[model samples]
Target: MLTDAQLLAAAARFGTPLYVYDAAELDAALARVRTAFTDTRLFYAMKANPNLTLLARMRAAGVGFECVSAGELARAVKVGAGGSDILVNGPAKSDEEYAEGARLGATFIVDRAEEVGLLPPRSRVLVRVNPALEVSTHDHLATGAGGSKFGVPLGGVPAVLNALRAAGHDGRGLHVHIGSAIRDATDFAAAFARLSELRPAVGELEVLDVGGGWSLDADLDGIADQARRAAQVFGAQLWAEPGRYLVAGAGVLLSQVVGLKATAHEFVLLDAGMTELIRPMLYGAVHPVLPLWPRSEAALHNTGTYDLAGPACESGDVLAREVPLPRPQRGDVLALLEAGAYGAAMSSNYLTRPRPAEVLWDGEWRVIRQRESVETIWAAET
Candidate 1:
């Protein structure tokens, strides 16, 4: 947990529009997961936050990694994760990625039958099964339901398994990722029960990868209980790939209030925008926003509804709407909570604005990533 002083100091030291991650919070998250899902293989889904420092910390904590690309796999290895400790998963994998995964001995979570042919013979693999069951979550985050572009449909699982067997790949397990930000335990239990039903069709499974999507607000005990049930029913090793659940609440994005706009609705314009944190614009997501420091009790209590707008030119660049906060003046710093996952990882050079710096604070603050400069942004331009 970062204090106002630490956040304020980070803003002062690194300038506004900075990402601050607390390593202690990350460790605590891992501890919570381990405590809840004891003995279950925990893989840190690198897509959520691929900061090298964070990867290193996770690796050191004896956590495996789930990578979606060769680059992510390489990052996992660079951070000290063994080849056997990584699982490669994605809807579309290139020949190069297959080659890399094969060379590194990383398990492949085959989403399509064609991907099975791309892997090395007798390679370790998990067939991603789309149970067509929808979890209670944002539609965009749902992956296992029918009409989804992600995993193999339920009806097609047997064919895909036969394809893997024919290809001589060791189809060790079944993987189900219904959706992300899943808060319901019944969803997990249902997904597992559904996958367990396929046991006869697949025959003698060795692993049940109840894929990542657990939300920070989800019932950990309920999820673990369901996972235990799945493991017992399938008589296989249980595994999970947790991304946002492990990191979303461990970070904060700091931005300085640049000015107040008097529009049809009052707006508090901040230096940070979609370029720094785009979840709000991307998913209509709401992140708790609060002033880092208040002048007095009155300043804290003098609240008004305002639209937290970003510096981005697009009208959709607003961070939050109808936000009730103390009257903010110019230079007031604001903190966006639950920004650890996908904050910096999903940021881009949109509008030619450089991505903000990222700092990791365990005990001492260290700049894990320097703020991108204009030259860095255009360095690849021919």
Candidate 2:
């Protein structure tokens, strides 16, 4: 773990409300995935963090990408992600996006029957099935199983595949996304078994993609266990799309403490609010916070109990509740840990607040992105 002093030095140089990413950590993560699943291909899910600098770093590490939107696909293309290597996936894709991806020659993971009609002739396709497995994570992050709006239900997928086969669509694989931030390996195994039961022949399956939900802060050993199990079961080419597990802990969000307020409960207001990170207020997401000033007893100080709220006007915009942290004072720099995924990408300009800056650190810790100015925000509005 990098010391608070080291992070503070970087924050002081880069300015507050900045995202500092550790490129070495990301590379190490990719290496771990490669080492663990020798037969499996790891595609970094770009929806988690779309910073072009991060994308470029992942590209350099030889990791493929899973793009959700056409813009993300375009970014991947710009960063040298070949269409044949990149996997195009999303719950709801526009016809234009579908055409663009097919025209560009990318592999498309078909999530619905309607998507098949939009595909170009001779396009490669993979069937995305909504396994009836429940994702143990937060409700909002749960993407697989029957209730999710993300994929084609299990019963509907075979028929769609049959229809596509009858139409001569190039259906070459099976894709299943159980959930996001999933911690249980047993759950993953169960989901895989279900997908396997649906499609028996390993020879016919070109790729069996277990959707990207491997979480980092959770039981990575469990994830490895599950991956090993699936590798043994499915001899076909394996693929995984992991977002948070790759980048969550590798990045940090630095914000200035604007003020402190005490009502029925104490609150530490931060300059970077939900406009910068909505996971907290949006899904009751919890992130560890570190205070830069008045460092006293490390044990008593950072026992990690505080309500870190954002500056958004809505009371629901609170970042974390009952979070543990060292005592923070006004103007103090607060480093939010495990903010690499869903941190800056989900930022908005709600309440007219200026979005924060982003920077990437390649072990040496240099600024890769600059802070946004008030003039820049106003210029867009005007």
What's the lDDT of the predicted structure labeled candidate 2?
0.78
lDDT of 2 by residue, 205-313 (tens): 6677886687675555566567556645655577888788788888888889898888887788888778888888877777887777766677464554567777777
Model 1, 162: alpha-carbon shift in Å? 2.5
Model 2 / residue 5 / CA error / Å: 1.2
Error of 1 at 76 (Å): 1.3
Q: How many residue pairs in model 1 have overlapping backbones? A: 0
Please report the candidate that would top lDDT against the real structure.
1
Could you tell me the TM-score of candidate 1?
Answer: 0.97
Candidate 1 lowest-lDDT run of ten:
113-122
What tens digits encode model 1's per-residue C-alpha lDDT throughout 92-192?
Answer: 89888888888888889989877766787778899898888878887888887788888887778888888887888887878888888877878888888
Q: For every model shown, what is its TM-score relative to the native structure? A: 0.97, 0.92
